[model samples]
Target: MPDSLLVVDDEPAIRHAIVRAFAELTVIEADTAEAGLAAVRERYPDLVLVDNRLPDGEGIELIARIRAIDPDLPVVLLTGHGSTDLAVDALKHGAVDYIEKPFKIERLRTTVSHLLDKQKLGRQVARLSGKASGRSHLVAQAPAMKRVLGLIRRVAAVPSTTVLIQGESGSGKELVAKAIHERSARAEQPFIAINCAALSEHLLEAELFGYEKGAFTGADSKGKAGLFEAANGGTMFLDEVGEMPLHLQTKLLRVLQERRFRRVGGLTDIEVDVRVVAATNRDLRAEVVAGRFRQDLYFRLRVVPVPVPPLRERPEDILAIADHLLKRLAPELGRPGLAFSDAARQAMVAYAWPGNVRELANAVERAVIGAEGDAIRPDDLVLDEILLEQRPAPAQVSAAVQAPIAASSAPASAPALPPGTLLIPPGERHLARIEAMVIKAALADAGGQKSKAADLLGINRTTLYNKLKDIGLEQAESAAG
Candidate 1:
């Protein structure tokens, strides 16, 4: 469909002329502010044109009314030859641009074209702002992320589809939920998230289904409303639902079936109009098989599942995410801003990243703290030992696993070595290599018997085998024989 326009002119001839000029435009005509306001309520136009002097209202007045419905809608004001002052006033009041009655066809066309482009950008900003606070406007261009954005758009239109966001931890499920809520019917309402695994059953129950005063000892004298009640007419995101206890799961399932709950010690049942969007890393279906979760509850929450992929699955997003994080962290860190070095960027894309986004964030935090220059480097990422363990070894590293003391395969460009000499590069020596050498030397002395070799190496047999594997020196089968 072509772009739609609402023309608010007192003269029918003027509206007809505009409609004729932009034949492809869908025009909605209104002669007065009342009619224009009604038109806006009935249909949202992509662009609006208003006469500076309407019979019942000023064009700026209609612009103000339109602003109430959609504050950022682009408006163009029409003015007479002597109404330049009124045109300026209209522009100030949020009309994007103004044109006099005698405006050239070209001038009007150009103005309208520019206004439409501006509106397209506005729509994009509006779309992105639905995600993370402040920076949800940072939209991605990657194909996978583009697909993710499309899913967010389609799913957000539905009011209460419990989105089951599955992803490696730290892949920004919470941000996705926030974006959905921001773009939905309840955009202006509250959005609350409770981490199901973060608290005990009694506390989780008390917090989720609020306890009335004296529901339990040490309770505050005044009772509290639960998150659902507090987030009434909005959204309540139950994060990490896989961690919720069995007893609380039943209450949660009941509330999902009927949006009503009883406070822990209160007689009155409270009803709420809250939409639930839950997220988790655990496979609830598997949990069901394990008898730790309710299948019915799983069905309810998975009404519209949104699985955010792991960072490793979308390594292409690492640079963008890193760029965004750096921009955000710079001012917060009170330091000179930084970005990732090419090597660092390569490292990020190559790493298996088992920790996902949280770990990526921590990695960036380390860079921000340790970096002495303008960009983050591989050296700056203080990865957890576990994550390091999961990463792939260098090509030469695999060779280290095969034989304990092979010729040191140093690159061949160095100065000539002395006859029968071994020269190990600086920083190239490692304990594995040393242990491999010792084991080889000892085995040679012991005539290849592991028991004798172990004694000769001064270590137990199992420890010798472990060292053999560690240093790429597991004995050859024939040699072991």
Candidate 2:
């Protein structure tokens, strides 16, 4: 579907000009704030361009209202040359950008294109992260993790049951929480997450339930909606739930029991339909016994307890998970096709991984960026004895397991590798070139088979095709040449 642009301006000339300039886009125009809001509710456009001087009210005010409806929506303000201050204020009020009245058509088009591209990328990233949080992406080759996955699947179908996930830090608790949320009936709704340990008690309360206008110092003038409100009709993941202050825990228990909560300083009770998924590294049972946590709240949260096993207990999954993460991380780090040597893989598998999967990902990312060639050596990893003990004997990393690692076995279109080599010339390591190279190699390896190539590269066939289309490799000749 073509993207739509909403132009909210009282000036006919400005609106007509915008409509004429973007003949490719579907332009919907409104001359007043009320009309613009109605258009927004009726047709959710990809972007909004609102003049600061709307017929009924200020564009900045409309921007706030638009944000209240959908915080992710992009709004741009149109301002007079003398109203630069108002433009800045509009940005502070959640307008993504502003344009002076006498703006160039090309500049406006460029700005709109840039913002649309940004929104597209944001959506793609969100989709990718959602996929990453699935059960399959959790890397459960080991029995312990397999059992954890089983438990998660069983409980995920229960929509309203509050889940308390206990695990060591970096043990993929959030991933499990997200998997449950995704599987539940509320899958289409929001999945808001916050760390209880990251904020002060007062701040956390406001964040959870929100506050009224001027309810506290430094608060937004327009009373903000809290995560609970934001997550209405969805799921909320409370990470480090054991760190919640006792006073807030009491309020949380009330919400669990009543399914309603009042804003921090507001009189009205706000109702929300949201599933609560709480996770913590600490033992809440122990915390309750020690008088640091409320027993009643603990029971409320642990309606179904899910335990995420640490990496040490799931040693068999270390290498496989590392390989999975490497494929995902390589493109993001702008070093496509980077892979760990057999020695480094052995070292990774042998390590205790005290910090769990999070640490492993960081180490892999560091190694990928630091590697001189496509093959990442132990030296490139810079892993000290503190992170890894005695390295296990070297084992061959399978070409099937890591397609980019075994470039020599790749197709004829792939650039010639000297021994174990695959890279662009020095100082020319651009993402596009590396991406094109990897795609060509994968396609070559699969004998021009897109689906098989996608499998080889650890990505979906559609994604592979999209990447090829994006990098001007859609045609066989481009891919081969």
Candidate 3:
């Protein structure tokens, strides 16, 4: 299908010229801002060309409305010689580009083509990143995971099918969703996700369907667009779908059936073209039998049910996944080039990961921070010691941050502060000064190794670098300097 363009201008001659110039596209024209907005609602165009001065309102004002409707829809401001200021203002309001009136038609055509091409390239890059990141996060060398991968590849080819992913917590259902979306034909579009169990029914309804301005107290005056509108031409991942409110489920079912829905406080029914990918830990069939889930919605979502195996079910993957996590966590935690000892490896494989991959990731992160040496010992695993050794209490962290200079166990050579002087204060300027001091102190304490300093501060090296820049402290600065 050819891409559609909307030209909103008061001048009939200008509109005629624009329509004639873009004969290759399906051109839609409107004479006023009101009519332009109506045309936008009627035909969702890929690009819009609005005159800076419209009969109903300035084109700049319409850009915000256009953005509220579809943030990514490209808009170009059409201006005359003296309207350059208005054109610039329109760009600030979300117009992608501006074209001067009495301009060369070829230049305008080239500009439009270039902007569209750039937008397409951006979407393509986002799609590729989604694919690469999803694949990397999915660590599946075992047969069970390989089977899961195969299923994802197969279903991804069918973009319109609603995929229901069943898995325990931390089994990476979101990763599977991304894989399917990235591989699908609609990869270049958005991938919007929501957790049904995370919000109250009222809030969930508002979030999913949006609301009109001043629909309720504290609502943004400009209103908002919902995930359905945001995810148009892409995929929507509804995590914990079984936990969705019954009334909202009915509304969701309507959208799935008719491909349209009305916002919470709006009368207009908005159309959307999006793929649905739902996931839940609960058995939807059982929920339906118990009368806790809607059968129609359940059946609609389960058209291609994909199950993700828990980490314990694939014991062969225990060591491999641990090693993979360590390779990532070790450097970030400042324990660069650290390795798991033979005993640690053995202990990892022996233990059943009840909390699944998430538990494993936390275990590795903790071990990276608390380990006494370069090699992670069996004792460092701490899986069996949760009951024996209490986790670090809140007081310990508080004391570390707030201890008085005289009370601190720092070396005698360490600079002393005034009695009862708070190292960090609530004020932004004071907090910044104290933060800089702390970074300087950590770098000094770590002998100026950025990674080691980051580890000492319980932050990643990248974060440390950003802080250093913020404090005007060069990375090369040492304790002596």
Which prediction has the highest lDDT against the true structure? 2
Who is ahead in TM-score, 2 or 3?
A: 2
Q: Encode model 3's per-residue lDDT on 240-291: one tens digit a residue.
A: 9999988999999999999999887788999999999999999675466335
The residue-by-residue lDDT of candidate 1 on 280-397, one tens digit each, is 9896754663457888899898888887876666655666677656654554565444777776765665566777777777888778888988877788986554454355433322
| lDDT value for model 3 | 0.77
My TM-score estimates for the predictions, one after another, are 0.56, 0.55, 0.53
What local lDDT does model 1 show for residue 453? 85
Clash pairs for candidate 1? 130-179, 131-179, 400-472, 401-472, 402-472, 403-472, 404-473
Looking at model 2, the pairs that clash are none
What are the runs in model 3 whose C-alpha is more than 4 Å off?
1-136, 385-481
- Total backbone collisions, model 3: 0
Worst 10-residue lDDT window for candidate 2 reads: 405-414
